[model samples]
Target: MELFTVKSIGKVCVDKKGTRLKLDKEYIPALTNLEGFSYINILWWFDQCDHSDSRSKLIEKSPYKDSPEMLGTFATRSPERPNPIALTCANITYIEAENGVVGLAYMDAEHGTPILDIKPYTPSLDRVENPSMPQWCASWPKNVETSGDYDWSKVFNF
Candidate 1:
């Protein structure tokens, strides 16, 4: 297998003020014209799960209620995986290109989480009008718009 070298371009910051992505000074120029996009797909590292044991995990006990008892790492969004990477789509609240900070409406990531990359969320390439899934999650929220109000506590096993 081929090996890869990855570096963090920025970090997520969540404070009493708000949540945002603070890009490195060198990466600030990449944010040019990014304000045109309404949403962005953020690629971040699961730093907390970057240990040898977490990276070696290929299977996990299901974390979703009513889901399969045991699931392969790829089947669920567990932070522990061969690569401790995560992707999240977030709405852009504001952007400070010169300052290299982005205001996000909401992101599931925690403060100080390393950001791997950021991509504009293009509907043409990302949306799926009809997605097939197991019956267990059929009752879950159907779209991102409604997901905010969804009672996720009921769906998570934890």
Candidate 2:
């Protein structure tokens, strides 16, 4: 197979201060007009889980309490994966295009995580009116808005 390459356009700034995306100087222009969207799909690297052992993990041993005991890597949103990449649809708190900074309401990424890319969250293309899932997770939140108030600790084992 031919080798492919991916580069970070920015980094996630997560701290006690807040969560934000700080784009590289060269990618600052790319943030133009991004403020128009209320939400954004962030593609980021799971840098902390990029080790060989994590990458080779193909099965997760019940990350969810009520789910099946063994779940294939693809079946669960576990960080251990071959690509070690993650996607999160986060609400935009604010955007500073000139300074290349985007404040976010929430992001499931660690501080200093490499940001692969950012795309406007268009419901027309990204949302599904009705999506099916396993019965195990049937009680999960139906949308991102509702997910904020969800009791995730009850759903997740870890």
Candidate 3:
């Protein structure tokens, strides 16, 4: 088997002050020109779920109330995958390019979560039009903007 090394470039900071991505000093240069983006796709580590038991979980017992009784790990966005990684598209509120700090309107990540990578959200490559999904989630929001007001509790069974 081939081995690869992954390093954390920064961490997601969710506090009373605000939600932001605090990049390490060494990665400050990488933030150059990122301000032009209105949104960013954040790849982060699910640190809390990085355990032997979590990693070994291959099936989930219906995370959605209206979904199938059993779902493969990949079918749902549960943190208990073989690799505890997560991705979220967050709206950019502000950016301090020089200081490597980025403020966001909202992010699904929790406080102190390690950020693996950040990519600008370009419509050309990121947007999906007329995408199909399971009937259970068909009533979900159509776009990211409207998703903020969506009643997520109705979908999640937890």
Q: How does residue 36 of candidate 1 score in lDDT? A: 88
lDDT of each: 0.93, 0.93, 0.93
lDDT per residue, candidate 2, 1-158, as tens digits? Answer: 57779999999999897999999999999988786799999999999998999999998798797889999999977889998999999999998899999999999898999999999999999999999989999999999999999999999876
lDDT of 3 by residue, 37-147 (tens): 999999999999999999999997987878889999998888999999999999999999888899999998899999999999999999999899999888989999999
Ten-residue segment with the worst summed lDDT in candidate 2? Answer: 59-68
Residue 96 alpha-carbon offset, candidate 1, angstroms: 0.8
lDDT accuracy of residue 15 in candidate 1: 98
Error of 2 at 146 (Å): 0.9
Query: What TM-score, to 2 decimals, does candidate 1 have?
Result: 0.96
User: Each model's TM-score?
Assistant: 0.96, 0.97, 0.96
Residue pairs in candidate 1 whose N, alpha carbon or C atoms collide under 3 angstroms: none
Model 1, range 37-107, lDDT digits (tens) per residue? 98999999999999999999999888889988999998888899999999999999999999999999899
